[model samples]
Target: MKKYALNLIFVFMTTAAILLNAYSCFAKDIAFQSSVDKNRVSLGDDIILSLTFTGTQSIPAPDFTNVEGFHAKYIGPSTMVSIINGSMSASITHKYVLIPLKAGKFQVGPVTFKYGSDTYASNILTVEVVEGPVSDNRPIRTAGVPPLKFEDKIFVVMEPQRTQAYLNETIPLKIKLYVNKLPVRDIQLPQFAHDGFSTEALDRPRQYEEIRQGILYDVLEFDTVIFGTRPGISNLGPAELDCVLLEKQRRTGGIFGDDDPFDDFFGKYTAYPLHLKSNQVSMTILPLPEEGKPQNFSGAVGSFDFNLEADPKYVKAGDPVTVKMIVRGDGNLNTVTTPNIGSQDNFKVYDPQFKQEGNTKTFEQVVIPKIETVTEIPAVSFNFFDPAKKQYVTITKGPIPIKVEKSTEREGLKIVEADAISRPLVKKETLGRDIIYIKELPGNLRKKDAYLYKNKLFLLLQSILLLCFIIIVTLNKRRERLKTDIRYARRIRAPKEARNGLKESKKYLSQGKIQNFYDTIFGTLQKYLGDKFHLPSAGITANIIDEVLKNKNIDERVLDELRSIFNECDVARYAPTEVSVEKMQNTFLKLERIIDYLERQKL
Candidate 1:
C-alpha cells in the first residue's frame, strides 16, 4: 500500500510541475497596442508613436535599440497602477517623438521588454516618408462638404499685407496653418532666407481654436517683416512649417476610444506635417523720387522739424559761440541734409560738426545737434518742402544778440543807465556835423615820398602777392569746373579708381584680409559715386542711383547692373560667410561691367 501511494504521488507531482512550466512559457499577464495616425511624414515633421504595456506587476523598461530607424526624442515615461473588484493591475509606458531627416519608407519593429526572465514585444509598425503633404488617410467632413482625406482636406497659407515695398519697408507677412479637429503641437521650423533683410520671430504663433473649411483644426499664425535690399521688386517666399497632430480613434463613450466596462481609456496618437504655402508675391519698389530731390536729402523720406540754439547769444569778439542745430521730427532725419551755415566771412566756422540720435526703424530722429562757434554769426535759414501740406517750409535762427567791445575786452557787457543814455542822445542832436571827405588824391599821395625805400619795397611785395593770388584763383576755378561736371569727372578718374579697387581686393583676398577687401570695395564705390554723381559716401543706395540714372536717361539695363553691384557689396558687408575666389571674380566682373556700362552711357 505504501509503494502504490508513492507512485501516484510521483505522477501527480510530475504532472503539476509540467503544467506550471507550460504556463510560464505560453501564458502572459502583459498586453500592448501599437499605432500611428500618419503613414507618411515630411522632413522636420513630428510623429508620435505610443507604447502601452500592462501586466499583473510592473513591466521592465524597454530597450529601444531594436527600432534603429527612428531619430527618437524622449517625450515622457509614465506608469499607472489600478485596483478594481479586488484585482490589481499595473503598467509602465514610454512615449517618444521621432522626426525624419529625409524622404523614404521605414519599418519600426516590435518593441520588446524583459522582466525576471520573461520577455514581451508589441506589434511591428511601418511608416512612409513622402516629399509633399503629411497626413493619415482619414476622412474629414464639415458644413455639408464632401468627405475629404486629411491630406486633401487641410492647408496652411501665408498672406502678406503688401507684396511689394521699398527697401526697408516693414511688410507684415502673416501665416496661418489650419486643419479639421486635430490636436496640434508647434514643431521646429526651417531657417528662412536672409537676403539683405533683418527678421524677428514674433513671441508666439497666434492660435485660433476654431474649425475652418468644415474641419475642426488648430489655426496657428504668426507675422514677420520682410525688408528688401533696396527699392526694387523682390520676392518674399512661402513660410514653410511642421506640426504635430493627434487623432482620437473615433471614441464612442470613454474619454478616449470606445467605452467598455473593462476597456481602459486610451487613444492612438500620431504626428502629421503641416505644409504652409503663400502665393508668389510681387512688390513694386517705387523708386525713390529723384526729381527735385535735395542734394542733401539724407535719404529721409518723411517730414521733420528743426531747431537751433547758441549757448551764449552775447559773446566777446574772440569768444566761441556754441551754435546747436537740433532737427527733430517724425521723418527720415538721418537722410536729411545737415543744415549749412551759409557764409563764414566774419566768423571762422570750422566744419559744421554733428551729433545724431534717431530710431532708424521708425524713420524718426529725436535730436541731431550740430555745433559751431564764432564771435559773430549771421542768421541762417533751412528750407524744406512739406510734402504733406505741399508748401515750402523755412526755419531761420538768429541775428543772434552779440556783445561788442574792443578787439580785447577787459570787462563784460555793461548796461547803460537811462539817465546817462538820454543825456548823450540830447547832446548828439544839438551838435552840428561837418563833412570831411578824403578823395583819392590820385598821384599826389605817391609824390609825398615818406620813408621812400621802405614804402617802395612794401608796394612791390604787395604786387607780387596779388599776382600770385590771381593765378591761384584761376586754377581753383578750373578745378571746381572739372569736379562739378559729372561726365568729365568720371571720364577722368573712374577707370583708374575702379582698377585700383579691384587690384587691392584681389591682394586682400590672397592675403586673407577680409575686412580690407570690404573696405576697398566700399570706398571704391563711394569715391565713384562722389566723382560720377557728386553724391557723398554716406548717401549711396540703389534708389539714389536709380533716380539719378532715370533722370539722366541712362539705359535701364545699365541701372540694373549698378543695383547688382550695390547688392553684392552690401552682402559682403553684413553676412558672416566666406566668399570663394570664383564668387569674388564673378562679383568683380559684374562690377566692372556696371562701371563700364555707366561710363559709356551719355548723361
Candidate 2:
C-alpha cells in the first residue's frame, strides 16, 4: 500500500510538471493571424474565416456585426494544446461563417480584438464572389433549398455531375451535410436509393463553412464515383443521414468572461437523434450508339489509349516470349477485358495475369513458339466507346518482326562411376573386446506397496494421474464446444479482437486522422461489448448500460467509466477538435481497463 501510494504521488507530480512546461511555452509569444478557408465562393456559398491567437486561449471574440458584401455569423471557437518531447505549443481559433451576397471582389478586414490591456490585429484577406455555380471551389450551395429560413437546422443535399450519361460511364457524385450554426455530433455516413447505378464507398468527408439564406453553416462533403448499369431515366437518391443534434440549454461560464473562447470546450448541450433527407434527381442513362459500334465493344465507356508490347523478338523454339497490353485513361476499367490477339495455333499460350492500378489496366501473357518457323507475334485490337467523340474507337497494334531459331542442345544421360580406396586391417583382438564377469552377491529385495509408507506413495502417484486425466478431458471438451458454439467462441476471443481494434486506432491516430481514430475506438468498444456479452453489435446503445449490465457483477466505478466513455465518444464524433490528444489517450486507457475487467468475468 505504501509503494502504491508513492507511485501515485510520483505520477501526479510528473503530470503537473509536464503541463507546467507545456503552458509555459505558451506564455512566450502571442501571434495574431487571419486566414480564410476559401478565397473565392459562389454567391450562396459560405466562407470560413478564422482568427487564430497563438500562445494563449484567453482572447475575446471578434465583433462582426456589420461586414460588407457578406453576411457573417460567429460559429464557436476551437482550442488546441500539445506537448511533444517537452516542446509545448497552444492556440485558440475563433472561426466565423461568411456568406457572400453578390458577385465581386472585396477585401475583408484586418480583424481587431480588444482584450484587457492588449490590442490584437489580424491580416487582411481578399475574396471574390462569383455568379451561377462554383466549379473550382469545393463548396457548393444546395440548388433547390429555399432562400428563407426553415425549421430544420440541419439537412443534406446530393448532386450528380451529369444528368444524362452513357451506360458504364463514370459519374462523379457529391453529397454534402450542412449544419446551420447548430451543435451536432455522431454523424453517420449517408445512405441513398440506388436501384440501377453501382457505386463505391464514399470517400472521407471534408468539412468547411457555407452560408445559405443569410445563415452561415458548417458543411461536410462526401464524394464518390458511380457507374450506370441499365440504360433509362432513373430517379436516384432521396439521400438520408443520421446524426445527433445538440440543443444548448444555456452558457456555462469559465474564469474568463461570458464570450470566453473556452465556452465550447466546457459547454453543456443535450443531444437528440435527427434524420435528414435530400430531394430526388432524375437521370437518363443512354446505351451506346449502335450505328458505329464495334463487334468487340465490351461496355467500356470512356476515352482510352491502348498499347501492346512484346519482348524477345528473337527466341529459340519452345522458349517463352512475353506480351504486355496496357489500357489507360478515364472510365471504368473493371468492365474492360483483355484485347484479342492472333496466332494461337502456332504458339502455346498460357492464361494471362491481369492487374489494375487507378485508371490503368494491365495484362501480362506468355506465349511459347511451338515450332521454329513462327516469324511474328499477332496483331492486337481493343474496342471502346468514346463518349466525347460519340463513336467507337478500335486501337490496333503489333505484328512486329521476330526471329525463331532451332534449339542446338541435345538431351542425354551419362553414367557416373565411384572410386573405392583400400586400407590394411589390424588383428581380430583389436576389433572385438573381452566379455564381462557377473557379481556373486545379490542386493536386498523389496515388494511394491507392502508397508504403510509404500502404500501411501503408490496412492499419491495414482491420484496425480487421475488429476491429469481430468484436466485433459476438460480441455478437450472446451475445444470441441468452441467449434460448435459461436457465442462462446466470440466470448472467448473478445479481448484479442479489442486489442486488434486498438492497434488500428493507434495507427490512424499517428496518421493525423482523428475522426478515423475515434471511429475505430468507438467501434472497438461496441464490438467488444457485443462479443463479450453475446449481443448484436448493431443494437448496442448507451441505454444498455442499465438494461444489459445492471445485474452483471460490474463495479460502480467501472460502470461510471463506461458511461463517461460513451458520452465522450458521442461528442467526439463530429467535434474532434474539441477532443484533445491527452483526452483520447486517457480514453484508450479507460477502454483497456474496461476490457480487462470484462475479460476476467464469465457471462
Q: Which number leads on TM-score?
A: 2
Model 2 bad stretches (over 4 Å): 1-49, 52-124, 127-152, 211-215, 251-266, 413-603
Find the 10 residues in a row with the least total lDDT in model 2.
136-145
Q: For candidate 1, lDDT tens digit of each residue in 154-181?
A: 5556677766554344456676666543
Q: What are the per-residue Cα lDDT tens digits for candidate 2 across 105-220?
A: 99998787665467888888888888976663343333344653544557899999988999998999999888764656667788999999999889877655566653556677
In terms of lDDT, model 1 sits at 0.56
lDDT value for candidate 2?
Answer: 0.76
* Regions of model 1 farther than 4 Å from truth: 1-142, 147-155, 187-191, 194-205, 208-218, 247-265, 271-277, 302-603
Candidate 2, after superposition: displacement of residue 340 in Å? 1.2
